[model samples]
Target chain A: MIYLLLFWEFFKIGLLAVGGGLVTVPFLFDLTEEYSWFDKRELIDMIAIAQSTPGPVGINMATYAGFNAAGIGGALLATLSEVLPAVIIVYYIAKMLKRWQDSPYVEKVLKSIRPAVIALILFAGLDVAKETVVDWQTAAVLVVLCAAMRLYKKSPFFYIAASAVIGLILKI
Target chain B: MVGLWQIYCLFFKMGIFTFGGGYAMLPILQSEVVRKRHYVTEDELLDYYSIGQCTPGIIAVNAASFIGYKLRGLGGLLSATLGVISPSLVIIVLIAMVLRQYMDNQYLQWMFGGIRISVTALIINTVWDMWRKSVVRVRDYIVFAAAFGLMWCCGLSAALIVLLAAGAAFIPDIRRLKK
Candidate 1:
């Protein structure tokens, strides 16, 4: 039943994750609250790893969550369920390219979904925010990250490394 | 001939090189699909990307699946999808296993705290970026504000918000077309 539920949840994500990969964040965020598949901090780590590693952010996340929840089979099943809809939908859309090509209706709908997705993503950020700020010193890390990101192009690799060192030194 | 092996190899290379997929992977995809294989036109790729955004699933994966299925039916689709995902599976599995060992270490916990803070910052930055990109018109501003308020205050599901926004976005277009 757990395996089936995982597949179903990801499959639904495949069906309605508008605006792109990160939009799936909100769905999985809700899942952590609803089920014990993985927790919010783990999801935040998954995001960091997913962004740093190769592959689509959404797929990496699903794979990580699936691996954590079940095992290898679960990972395979979760990924399969997630991409199955794409194969079906894209297959048909390719066939009917004439009807859908640059369809204004499609563009407008997507445009609208973008902001909604941003809102949802921001909400997910708050979940991570709760776990991230344990003390004033730890809270200081958040302030620094936010400040560094705003100032210049600090490569993620360097940024993460610096943060880890700060954390280790502060022991927060 | 661009056989299954070639398809697999090419996509696998893409999986390895392309970090932070979706729109970020577009240029590489164009080079591989359009310039190398001539599987689809640049215009066609852009079209697929546009539709991919509206459709379910990741845009990059959808684009890959579409191009693969276009070039070689089910075999092409399987090869490409597997190729793109294989790298992540291998890397993430290995990383997860190693991380599992250090899950309780105090030092690692502190590191995770910093990483999570960084992630939160990244996510918030992403929100601002998306907001700037999407909310151009006054009407768009209204929809965006309404969606945020409804979701935050009412605790509505993203699915419901997307559905409502989609309906609202298309209604004006439909009315104009009717006239």
Candidate 2:
């Protein structure tokens, strides 16, 4: 029953999280509230884990949520559920590329989705900021990173690594 | 069957090297998969990236699956998916095992603290880039603002919000059809 629920929950996430992985965070927040599977603090921890680790944040959270709720099998079920919609969609899209390649409606729909996706991305940025920028020191790091990105065009990994080092040195 | 090893190696490199996930992986995938390898064209990759965003799974995995399926069907899909996930699986297992002990360590905490801030910046940067490249009209601006406001202020379920937005988008078309 738990596995089925896990699959269904993630399937819905997969089907609807149209923008990307970060866009799923808000939904997962609501999901945790409803399910009692994990609490807000754990969700933060999952975010940390998901961000620090590889793979998509949404998939990582789903796996962790499933594991918390129902162990290994649940984890597998959740992961598979999360990917299933994409797999199916991509498969069909791949099949129909030739037919739909020149469709103006398709182009228009894609064009329309871009703004919504940008909105979703902005929401993700705000959500992460609320969690990470609690203090002035961290806030400074954010400013510096943003400047580096905008002004210098420095690689993001460099900023990430530099911030980690600064955090270690300053104990902030 | 054809050049399977090369494909696996290529995706594995992408999976391992990308630090910020999804958006960050875009350029890397574009360079290695599209420009360097000639596996897919830039337009196709952009389309794949768009579809990857709308679909579930890791965008990297979705991208890999599409590329793989395009190249060699099921076998390609499995290989690409595995390749995309392999690095993360290994890294996460190691971190999960070791991180609990370091949870209280000040250095580790500070390092993660810094990383968290940087992650926020990266996300903002990506968002800005997407907005510049995308959002074209006033309606687009309105939709973007509305969605962001609803999510941040109301803490609404994202799934429901997206559905409402999609329905709202369709309403005009539906009315036009009636006329």
Candidate 3:
């Protein structure tokens, strides 16, 4: 039963997650509220791992969320369901590339989707902030990370690893 | 024609080596698929990327499926898609399994405490980047505000807001097309 639910939820995410990997973050955040498969703290960890790892962050997230919920079987189902939509849509679109590419309808949808995706992503960041930034120490860490990330323009993997080392040293 | 196994192996290799997420995969794909294998032309790779952006899934998977379909039909599509995700599934699950074992370890908790703050910072940075890239036009800002309001004040689901924004975005284009 949980497997079926996990599949359905992730499939819906796959169907609607346009733009790129980070767009899926909001949907996964919604899942933390709707189910106890993984909590918000675990979600933060999942995001860190996914961002730092290889392959697509969205796929990495799906696998992590599923595994947290129901072990290996759940992970497999969640991952497959998440990619099912892409497999189906890409197969058809690949055949008639010119027609679809030139279609005004597709262009309009994409144009519209961009702003909405940004809003959703912003909302997700705030939601995460509310969860993680509890005390002065965490808040300080957040501030420094935000500053460093903006100033440096480094990959996310660097920040995540650096923070883990800091966490161990500071004992916060 | 490239064999299905070869396609799978190449993508699988990509799955392991390419870090820092989907956008990072592009250089590797360009070098391997376009320059090394001649699987697709440079123009075709760009086309796949743009198409992948608009499609409803991870850009990496969508692009892989497109290239695979072009290369060897449905089997190639499956092979490529599977190859791209195989590493993620295996690696994340392994990490999750190990993390679960340390579910109550104090040291692990402290490490994650820091990780959590960093994750929030990363998300905020991502949002900043997205806003800069996406919110160029006045109409786009209106869409952004409306979507934010609906979610924050009205508690509308993200999926519903996306659908409404897509519909709203199409109106101007549709009216122009009618003219």
Best model per lDDT:
3
Q: Docking quality tier of candidate 3? A: acceptable
Candidate 3 lDDT, A76-162, residue by residue in tens: 999999999888998888877746756887666667777876676677667767877888988888999999987986655566668
lDDT minimum window of 10 residues, candidate 3 chain B: B18-27
If you assessed candidate 2 against the hidden native complex, which CAPRI class would it receive? Answer: acceptable
Which regions of candidate 2 fall more than 4 Å away from where they truly are?
Answer: A1-51, A61-85, B1-60, B63-77, B96-99, B153-179
Counting only residues 3 or more apart in sequence or on different chains, how many pairs clash (N, Cα, C under 3 Å) in candidate 3?
A: 0
- Across A125-171, the per-residue lDDT of candidate 1 in tens digits comes to 67667767777876777887888877875544455567768768877
Instruction: Write model 2 residue lDDT over A31-69, tens digit each, in one string.
Output: 877898888898888777777565666666666777677
Candidate 1 segments exceeding 4 Å error: A1-78, A90-101, B1-84, B91-99, B170-179
In model 3, residue pairs whose N, Cα or C atoms come closer than 3 Å (at least 3 residues apart or on different chains), thus clashing, are none
Q: Compute the interface RMSD for each candidate structure.
A: 5.9, 4.1, 6.0
Candidate 2 residue lDDT tens string, B14-129: 77655445765665565567656777865566557656665555676688888887788777776777677656555554454566566567777788777767778877876666
The clash tally of candidate 2 reads: 0
> In candidate 1, which residue pairs get closer than 3 Å at backbone N, Cα or C atoms, i.e. clash?
none
Ranking by TM-score: 2, 3, 1
The two-chain DockQ for each candidate, comma-separated, is 0.39, 0.38, 0.44
What lDDT does candidate 2 reach at residue B27? 52
Stretches of candidate 3 exceeding 4 Å from the true structure: A1-82, A93-98, B1-84, B91-99, B171-179
Range of the 10 consecutive residues with the lowest summed lDDT in candidate 2 chain B:
B166-175
TM agreement with the true structure for every prediction: 0.60, 0.69, 0.61
Compute the DockQ of candidate 1: 0.39
